[model samples]
Target: MLRTTVARLTVRGLLGSRRGLLLLVVPGLLLLMSVIARGSSADKQQLTATILGQLGLGTLVPLLGVVVGTGVISTEIDDGSIVYLLAKPLPRWQIITTKLIVAVLTSWVVAAVPTLLAGLVLYGTKDALAVGYAVGVLVASTAYSSVFLLLGVVTRNAVVAGLAYALIWESVVGNFVEGARTLSVQQWGLAVARAVAPHGGISTNVGLGAAVPLLVLVTVGAGWLAAVRLAGLTLAAGD
Candidate 1:
């Protein structure tokens, strides 16, 4: 269901624009902070857990998700360029999937790579902390792309809506509300990290059994929804 033509245009729009700078800057900040943290006198394992788990996974991953995820398609819709995709004799699912593929792969490089590098800088490879959090960030990146892409497809204020959901609901509410943690992408990622590095001191409210299924469900479900919604958007635009 991948289309190179659509994927090429999506990459140009997402990375060849000013927003591409953000994709670099955010990850740059994480690396810088990690270097600074490495020089500190704090416990190495604790620092790794806090920085990689909380800052990298909880913050940077999701923020990049919103940026890359929504950016893939929202700008085209806003500038009335999405008609090009609709004009093609292609299925809407292929269109959404192609854009989502770009978002996920871009996010892995921009966000997940930094997590791995930062994890190493902060705590080395002891207990596989770097690889573990990097894997978690990878998973969260995919799920976030699908979800925020759906928001981009169905809403006019995709950036604003995505930021609100990520900052307010995912970060804040998901932290304070007990029931919210179960559904948090951040928490689910933490679960994966725990599994990857069982001795790495990673901790989260979710267990791997539930988190695995939830992650799969959200990623696949949101992508499917975006495809369905995209058809409606094409119809609405036509009329």
Candidate 2:
């Protein structure tokens, strides 16, 4: 069935192709930043917090999620190859689910692991910061992957939209707009960090109670919508 095919394809594309190389770039950058941060005799706490919050959580995680998530479907759609599967008896939801799983896992490995390593390099188990950020990255990775994958399925402009959400909305506006902070994924991940971090080490614009529900809602709701949209997905002929 399409599900099996999708699973096979997802694994192969994620692990075997040149596309897998893209997943390495963010984590590699994280490592590089960690080294540079260590050399400055910076305030270890502030440096750790800045790297984890500003770069790791804010930039790298979302960028990896967008790349992996959209790569799962967008490449195929662009080449008109999705029709090979869509034209068959396979249900489109299967493809969406398999791709979602692959994208989420890829995002976690590339974004989350490097975050923990960077945390360790910067702070070394201090205040459980590494563990906290790792958890937040996983949480944010799931939601981001779902949203971007949906964008990939539905729009040729998926990367642009994903970048806008990650950079402009989450990074730029979330910093200034108090209400927007409540709705942002960065804030949601920070909420998870607030829960896991030692005492006051981590804080978030959105409270633990509100953030937990919003994270669940956004991640699950977006995933569900992605499956539904994939089922009804359409592909037009050559441009």
- Top candidate (lDDT): 1
Instruction: Kindly list the per-residue Cα lDDT of model 2 for residues 160-229, writing each as its tens digit.
Output: 9988888888777876688788888888898898789955367567888888898889877877887777
Model 2 poorest ten-residue lDDT run: 230-239
What is the C-alpha lDDT profile of model 1 across 14-49, one tens digit per residue?
Answer: 889888999999999999999998999999999988
**Per-model C-alpha RMSD:** 1.3, 2.5
Report lDDT per candidate.
Answer: 0.90, 0.81
Candidate 1 lDDT score at position 194: 90
- The TM-scores, one per candidate, come to 0.97, 0.91
For model 2, name the residue pairs that clash: none
Count of clashing residue pairs in every prediction: 0, 0
| Model 2 CA lDDT for position 77 | 78
Off by over 4 Å in 1: none
Q: Which candidate number maximizes TM-score?
A: 1
